[model samples]
Target chain A: MKIFELGKAKSPWILHYNTGSCNGCDIELLAVLTPRYDVERFGMLNKGNPKQADILLITGPVTKRCRERLLNLYLQVPEPKVVVAVGTCSCGGGVFRHMYNVENGVERVIPVDVYVPGCAARPQQIIDGVVKALQILREKGRALEVPPHLKKIVRGREGGIDRESLLEDLRRR
Target chain B: MKKIKVNQEICTTIPMGSQHVALPEPVKLVFDTENEVVKRVSFDVSYVHRGIEKSLTTMYDFKKAPYVVGRICGICAIAHSIACTVALERSIGIDGEVPDRVRAVRMIGLELDRLQSHFLINGHLAEVCGYENIFMHLWRCREFILDTADMLFGNRVQYDVVCVGGVNRDIDEKTGTRISEALEEIEESIGFMEEVFTRDKTLVKRLEGLGVVSKDKAFEYGLVGPSARASGVKTDCRIEDDWGMYRDFGLEIITMTEGDALARCLVRVLECFESVRMIREALDSTSPGEEIQLRVRDNPKKDAVCRNEAPRGELFYYIRGTGKKIPGRVKIRTPTFANIPILPHVMIGVRYNDVPPLLMSFDPCLSCTGR
Candidate 1:
């Protein structure tokens, strides 16, 4: 790892993806980044490109048609990533939970490290959720730096958690 | 040594969105360009569809429809809620007229909603033009309005402020005073931004002549809201409808002759100032302590169409109510859906690079379109 990797905990570029949301949560998510809330003070950047992002901030429920594109975006982001599901719908499809076209929530398609709950999550709650995501990313980054044999002893197993199977079970539920 | 096939016109394609920095909502625009001039355009606005209309009719009852409709478009939630409730109220036919206080409160919510939306669009258009400083300043100024909204109502975005018979919330003298002060502050700051937007050489040069839409083309494309008003349509639902308190308030329908991006921006800016004044006027005219709601004796057994001027344009809500608690069918015609037909027409003949700013000028909300 380069010496610059030490700054990973402070500066995490976020990828914001809207997956068929009503836009209530998406606008609130944007609110957290503006000067009023100023989440940028923590060095969090909203990077539209997934490939260059370190954390994925997803708003809205995972609609059937948008699931593939969303998953593709998640896969495009490099590893040592964290996913933060913002809003009630993004967590469990708040008002849009029962619509036929919706897949319920984003967690059904991707593993979520943190879930921020609100009809439209308040900017304060979103900023808190992002702060938590930053901590999780730091842990994931540290896990990547550790030797493979030591990683098992330091954490739990050879690998962290299988997010794909976890996502499948979440969908089944 | 290379052989070229001659005699054919060359056209290239540029796929713009679905998840772009310029557009917060999901929409994909495909532009067919001939040597950097757009020949045609196709839009994919289904990315934000979440079966809201189906849910409105099947899953939720009529009384709950207003709150549900508010979720359809976060930016226009207050407008949707007011329109949905008014439609139901018309169909239900309560014993007496809707209380004057209720109408005034609803109007305040709507005007506030439009205020924030206009501010947001102005900032977003600035951001799309790569003017981050102006975007930040505009949003910073908008925060006062959002804070006032949060103070008067409970939430910022999905304000469950409007209900079936009347509004779910009310404002006190203190909150009203606070809102007035906030509006004064906002107007001062936004006036500075309006000046900057008009006077800034780069912004003016980029937006002045680009994406020109003639009045004839605007009418032909069936444009609605600010997009149409910018082209001198001289049409607005509030002016035409006498059912609401707007007629009593006597608000003017603002229009401009130029149909370019700059004209649209000016329309939104001028409208923001007007909305602030309207809210102030509403505060004075409304009687205090009047009952905000009336008890409905029965469900609406008829069909009614409710139209409101949302931030982007005119939003039409068509509801067919049975004798039951649930509605039979709920059809929504959002402004973006009506405005989207003008997209290809406006984007044509403009450079490929101007597509983003031109599209932002209309401030198309994809959630409204798909829902």
Candidate 2:
């Protein structure tokens, strides 16, 4: 891991966007970040703008209207960022699954690095999910850090990106 | 200073939300301003609509409907759950037979839910007013109420404790004692916050006389909950309906006549004390030996309406059941649905930067509105 990867883990500024689920998961996320649970202890800052975000925490099952806004927000966060879906609804639509207006999970629109499952995912589970996201960031940080010639070689893998060994190494980390 | 009317011809428009710092949910408000003062305003509130009507009536079973209805708004899940359950029970004609103990427990859940919600909105009002420290303080104080909820119901955000005929969780002696103790601790902080919110010159200056919705205007919008009471309308659904044991506990309606943001804040703060009083009396009077869940065997064959005082205002649910496992029609008109329309009515004369606090003062919950 690059030395800067330590800084990334220590002070990850996170951006939160709600797609359309009932606010159960969103309030839990805010509670976990408060002084009582304090997600800041893990170096998380809940930034409002996507451009400054290093990790994106999204709640809600993507709805028809929010899908475009969700995709736009995901794109706005500069790369080396990892997406964490923070509730059961965001993971696979939970109670809202098969509803007419719901588009289901965030993964249907954008890649999710971690899925935190619960009706309104608990604060402890949210902290655990966020820690997992930081590990994914460390791997992406190193891969994106390589020079243009080496980056092209890494990006040319069979799946269009090299993450096969990185997953295994992350489990160990 | 002499009164001057700015020309509307040189106005510039500004659009806020769908996603913005001041809003937690998606909503768009376009303001047509003549320089700094807003001349005209419009709102778009359909962004959070997720086909709740379909889910409530067709997708979920009649018995499981309360849990589904609970998802309408995370902050006010208990209120929705209770309202939907009562409506279903009324249509089926079995709520009168529900045990008093179950109603008492349900009241505890409602009051605790009300306490936390009042804290959430009051603190967010402070946040939008740029008083981050007070926001933190109020929310930090709110954790006590949340912990009390976790003790009684199991989770913090969505309690999911309300069922069709009764409640899901039964309170033990141990938990009941703890709940009262937690409320005592919260009461101390509530006093301090009342002092802070009342005496803080900055908050008073920012909120006073801003977003003045007159009693007539409040009635014009059909405003519900604390919003209506703040406008000098002494109406509360809890007193109007005999759903819970509020009548037995002697729950008095609280109101103010100022019809401004500060009045709304003061009304909510005073009501929190009223809620605490009810909870304390309820814990003292009710013994915990009754059955929590009643076996409700009948299905609905008629239409019924249930109204409850959500922390924000009156939450009304209309359910039509046709003796089938699925409901025939379900219509949920949330408090925010009635309250958001009042935005354009009130914001037409306020300054631009005052928009966030004014909007927050109404406690806009777009998810509740659109759903």
Candidate 3:
């Protein structure tokens, strides 16, 4: 419990990956770190290598060729990590959803904890999403706090929601 | 009789990329060489063909078309937006001129883009010449231009300023003053840059007589913007077409007869100064008014051809609407594609080591070509 508390307080390092976006979303992500937004105050730093990151911040809809590379990179991030899907494109494949050439969104391939929505999400919203993801990380330890009735539905014999089925349903919708 | 003997067996073809340092964006180049001298260069630019034209036809409604089309070229985003809107305006018969403030602000944004892109290309040229100091100085100065752009358009590179009928953003007194001050500072800095560019013997020697495009050859190859102007050809889409504020502003088209890499460099540098002046002029007299944009009335019917002078060169947008929200056919022809035809002609008979600087002389953006 003490170790979990320390890890939560320390704040996780982040890695930014661009699947196949027009440079629009890519530049805005950098703008978040610039002097104006100064996202560093929250202790989030962009790590070039995925092995060192605790959060994977992905922009752009997943393109065909980038999917394998993206998955390989995702696997490289240490376990119990959270993913923040930034921008409308990554959320629901905003403008590029119907391209037929790309995975609909980042969530299609990866488990995303928070979704920040914008044509390209504003920097403030992106920061808020990351902070919210940190809160989610802290709450996982209190799984026992769930009421008896809800616990059965959540931690059912199958142990909570089947993310794959949920994603499939989303895809159909 | 004595006849010159030549062997075709010795000639070799050299391929430079869809991934090469010479081109900033992805495009493949296959060059045939004879004795290490390039003979012919062919372009293979299908790498990033995202089927943008097809998507414009099927995906976007006419109302949503502006934002979608704006994504075609990040470097020339504003130009695409303006051209599409103009084409739409013509098609729907949306008569009555856009208010003076809208016109002026649009001009300011367009010129700011031109300044940033020109400065960036010039910096890249200096980098290719191995003049790291000039490159750094130019880019550092360019930061100011980018910041100004960010202030004006909300984003630096993709400048989301142009809407369907008018502009998305307006310039109030506060921003107008900031822009004027920034322009003055950049204008001041340009003097020092000019000194370095002119006095640096290494830069001058590297660029002088490199990739010379004679006036006749330039015309024959269909060179556009500063590339053609370097060869003393007077052609600029803004000047020729009189799109928005160009006719009112009375722009002085810059031309040079040297037709070398240095001339092209100088033309772009001078154009940067001219852009600052134009922005200043536009800002001073222009006053904000209501209605930055009018609601799009109807979808275009006949094929509409629109063109503009982007920072790189001439950018053309062709759209055909079939009364549906989406366009029937959308075609984009960028300046880099037009300039690519002349690369082999310039490279042929030139030394192998000189290939990089010569290739980058046009400031090629392969993304535009591939798109």
* Count of steric clashes across candidates, in order: 1, 2, 2
TM-score result, candidate 3: 0.74
True contacts kept of each: 0.81, 0.53, 0.10
Candidate 2 vs candidate 3: the DockQ winner is 2
Residue-by-residue lDDT tens digits, candidate 1, B254-300: 89998989999999988888887888888888756557767767897
For candidate 2, report its TM-score: 0.93
RMSD, model 3, all Cα superposed? 10.0
- Inter-residue clash pairs, candidate 1: A89-A94
lDDT, candidate 2, A46-136, per-residue tens: 8788898999988888888999988899889988999999998899988889899888888999999999988888889999998898888
Report the Cα lDDT for residue B281, model 2.
84
lDDT of 3 by residue, B1-371 (tens): 11222464555666664333334344567766776776666776655445567777877776777787666565566777777777776666663566778878878878887887777677777877777677667777777887888788787667777777777878888988888889888897677677766788998888899999999998898899889898999988987765677777778899999999989988887887888888888887768777787776666776777788887788887877677777788788888888988887788888777887887778776556655
**Candidate whose lDDT is highest:** 2
Each candidate's DockQ: 0.62, 0.51, 0.10
Ranking by lDDT: 2, 1, 3
Off by over 4 Å in 1: A2-4, A148-173, B1-7
TM-score preference between candidates 2 and 3, better one: 2
